[model samples]
Target: MSLLLDGVTVGYRGRPVFEGLTLPPVPAGSLVSVVGPNAVGKSTLLRSIAGLLPVAGRVELTGESLTAMPRPERVRRLGYLPQTLPQAVPLVAYETVFSACRSALGSWTNADTEAAIEAVFDRLGIRHLALRRLSEMSGGQRQMVGLAQVLVRRTPLLLLDEPTSALDLRWQLNVLSAVREAADAQGAIALVASHDLNLALRFCDQLLVLTPSGRIAMGAPEVILTPELLASAYGIEARIERCSRGHPIVLADQALSTG
Candidate 1:
């Protein structure tokens, strides 16, 4: 397993969000989805794995303690795509992609960087926009470029925060498929925080659901996304139906409250 959180407790500014958050180590080359209502500390758990947030409990990647590694080294080993990516400085699309490779391939040559950048663009279906400026692209294109960074970085562990939040429907499907392909193709572990339960059900193999206020309901989606769990966490009735594939299609039972 490349990712392990052993009794990890996380918070922001001394306010604990989740305590004693523990899960069995996940096997590599699998996609793990984190789903919960807002403010549930899903992002907090991801940030901790990315080493951007402090963890009260142990966090290990590839059997190495996150605290034991320096920032650059850890970043080199892990790719983090936060929800809000900074605006590119009017750089051409290809240039921006090339810049991301500096961390992975080093500062030697922009030649190799340029080649890999184009390859990523081709693989991601964005090669046509290579000459365009960052400010000119639509929201979804910008999101794709932001995602291209983590791809060009080519790290073994990817932590994505609501990766499809800014994308439209087609782009959303493309981006999620790309995420799965990238992770499995390279044998890297990926953890994604998503609000779209249906999308997660379609794409991910495992799940770690959080409470509305932030605590672990740690298990597979089938085990954790029951009517009882949904009633308690979201105060709504939930029906989990199985299609022919055995994957659950969740429907919110609208009889929420009001006697």
Candidate 2:
């Protein structure tokens, strides 16, 4: 399984966010992080791939054209979690997840659907929240439920927009670990849009950086996350250092003035 984007362009009111964007084919079981400063089109990129936006070119998955596929078929193959938190509704966590599971896997037996929901809740350590109402939960808790909704679908491709944004450090690690495990075990591809460079470096197999001037860089974190890249992409004077475990970490010293 692989995902390819060729000459993909997305915009609002004809103002292009991504103009003719193309990327190398992403193989299955790879976890890629899309990182860049605000308004650099990270969300737009994921949205286009998720078939939620209009595009100019081709988006293919394993030789099938996602852009041309029927909406139901495309949704079955791709799961997307937006950056916004799940709505605070009257539904409890378990009920919400069950609804999501039923919607995606309508043919599944009730027992199987319940089993999947339980498994995802256990994996994400959100089982305790199962009985809690969404309206009573915090933003972070709601975010975790949002993720569980996607995870239970078992789609071949996951597009998560800042899945860890509202999560604390421990929960952030938990979320990324779960996502990584899902990708590896299912031979699926996950594209996560994140602002946290450190977590991306630690958990992602590849990094897709969007620069302020509209350049795109894709490679291993060590190869693509250089001081120069940071300056150009984020307008920061930064250093890429290695942690104790040899993971690359970005150390920002100062922000560079655009003027």
Candidate 3:
């Protein structure tokens, strides 16, 4: 249920982004959120865990090493929905997501596939756009399609890259709540990269705040979302407050001073 990385270092073509990024041992059925300055390798970390990028560390799920595993094998256990869903081909929105299981869903009839696809669309509130082409949809709509593709995957480990960026406020809460429901009902572990700090604190059981320099700042919301950490990571004076329900909120105190 947990996705553990030990001394993880990720890079591209020999150019490093993060080094010695050791995450603590998180228990099962946990939702962990990662927030950092733009281009701090947040997406790269997600890609590395999903097997889309190679790294010089161990990524394990429930004590099982995931490095170098075959893509199909990994797909059975891990579901990845990237933030940017490039139109790989001129695909109808429904068809693109249905193709995710094209390899393993061989024997299922077209009717069955359609039914399954419809269910996914219905879950994400996008069933009405079944026949539309991907290129014609707005950025937010296309992002939902990408998420639907991964949600179609009934796996234990879910990796979402900026799941709420393109989504509006309501969908942001909806999608993150969906992640929480998945963990509660199915005993799943989710690693999410998100920009909305409040949603992350509210929905995620744990927080993994990556610094602007790509260092690891891991803990619960209260421990990790302090003014000191915010100032260090985002270079802004911020105060972390607690709501009546005990959830956290970050109040930015001042703009940066160019000294």
Candidate 4:
């Protein structure tokens, strides 16, 4: 199970944001994080692969073309969570999640649906809020609920854009852990777009760094998260170190003086 992007180009209107972009095929059950500075087309890349944007390239999953698939079929195969959370609806968390599940697969037995929703809420540690209304939940809570909607789909390809932007420290770690577990246990491909370098380095199996020059660096976190690359892509002086647990950590020392 490999996700392929061959010579993909995407942009707004007639302007090209990224051109001739190609990423190495990632195997099944891998979590890949896309990291870079603001407005560097990180989100655009995910949107393109999610089939939300028109692009000139081939996006394939398991040797099948995702770009040419039908919309309903594509929805069942690809799950995308955008950066912005949805506006508060009048329904409870359970209802919201149920609606998402219904939309994803069209039809299901009532028992199966209820069990699936409960399982997802339990995995996300949000089962306590299952009865709460979305209008009453906090931003972070709503974000987790939104995640439940996506993960419940159990798609082959998962594209998340800034999934942890609204969460606190604990939830941030929780969300990534759930994503990692989903990929590992379900044999899915998870691609995340994140601004947090530390979380990406800690949880993601592979890192793709989108540079300011529109170039990309793809490899393991330790190999890609270098001082030179950080300085070039983010304009910050950073040091790579290992914590007491032996996990890699990126420490930003200072900002480089840009002329």
Candidate 5:
């Protein structure tokens, strides 16, 4: 399975942010990180691929055009977590996640839904929050609940927009680890949009870099995340080094003079 983008064009107000952009096919069972400076089209790209935004070219999954699929079928095939978390309603955390899976299945029984919800909650280590009302939870707790909702859907294509934004350091690693495990276990294609360079490099298998000009570069993180590329993309002088554990770490020493 693969997700392919061919000549994709997206914009707002009739002004093109990126035109005729084509990406290499992202293989299934892989976790890829989409990284770029703020205001680049990273989120837009995910939204366009999720069929939330109108796009000009083709977005395909496993040789089938995603846009041509019915709305429900499309929904069943892809899971999208937006940058903004949902508003706190008078709903419990488990109920929200269970409802997401129920909606996807359309006619699943309560027993089945409960079983699925429990499995997801356990996987995310949020079983304790099962009965907690959304209104009573903190922002980070709510964010984790939102992630559980997405994970319960079991969609083959997962688009996560800053899923770790509201999370603490521990939950950041936990969420990314769970996502990677899901992709590996289910053969899903996961694209995560994040601002944390080290996190992306550490957890993701492939890096899709959205340059400041809306151009893209794709490869292993170590190869693609050079000082020159960092300077060009972020206007920073960065040093890519290995920590004590021998993992790559990017140290940005100074901001470049772009003017």
Candidate 6:
């Protein structure tokens, strides 16, 4: 299974963020990070793929046109977590995740649903927070709950917008690791929009870079995370160095003057 975007165009009020944006098919079991500076359309790209925004061209998944699929079918095949955190409701974490699971998988029996919920909570290491009310949880805890809500759905395609933005360093690693594990276990395709290049390089199989000037780059981290790409996309004079574990890391030595 794979996702293909062909000549896709998206914009707001006739002002195009990107036009004719196409990419090689993103295969199942691959976790891709969409990275760019602020306002470079990372969120817009995810929203477009999630069918939350109007688009001009083809978005197909395993030969099925996602743009033309029925709403329920689309919902079943894809799960999206927005940049904004879930609202601080009076509901407990378990209740919030349960509602999301039931809403997405209505045919699942209660026992199966609870099992799935428990599995996700365990995977996220949030079992302790399950009974805690959302209003009582910190922003990071609530963010984990939001992710659990999406993860419990078990959709084939996951579009996560800044999934770890509010997380601490350890939790960020945990969240991305969980996401990567889920994608590999289920043969799912996960497109994560992140500002943290080091984390993306470490966890993602591929990187989709969006430059401020509307350029797009997609490849393995080693192939795509170059000094030139960094200078152009982020306006930073950065060096790419391999970590002790051989993972690529970006070191921003200086910021280029935009003026």
Overlapping backbone residue pairs in candidate 6 total 0
TM-score of each: 0.91, 0.98, 0.89, 0.98, 0.97, 0.98
Candidate 4 minimal-lDDT segment of 10 residues: 104-113
Residue pairs clashing, model 1: none
Higher TM-score: candidate 1 or 3? Answer: 1
lDDT of each: 0.80, 0.94, 0.80, 0.91, 0.91, 0.94
- Number of backbone collisions per candidate, in order? 0, 0, 0, 0, 0, 0
Q: What's the distance in Å from true for residue 97, model 4?
A: 0.6
Candidate 2, residues 1-259, lDDT tens digits: the string is 9999999889999799988888999999999999999999999999989988888898999999998999878878999999999999989999999988888778999999989999999999999999999999999999999999999999999999999999999999999999999999999999999999999999999999998799899999988899999999999999989889887889999999979
lDDT of 3 by residue, 126-196 (tens): 88777888878887888888887777665788889988788798878778877887788778888899887
Tens digits of per-residue lDDT, candidate 6, 88-163, equal: 8999999999999888788999999999999999999999999999998888899999999999999999999999
lDDT for model 2 comes to 0.94
Q: Candidate 2: which stretches are off by over 4 Å?
A: none
lDDT of 1 at 216: 60
Q: Which 10 consecutive positions of candidate 1 have the poorest summed lDDT?
A: 212-221
lDDT of 3 at 26: 70
Tens-place lDDT per residue, model 4, 108-146, is: 777878888889999999999899999998888899999
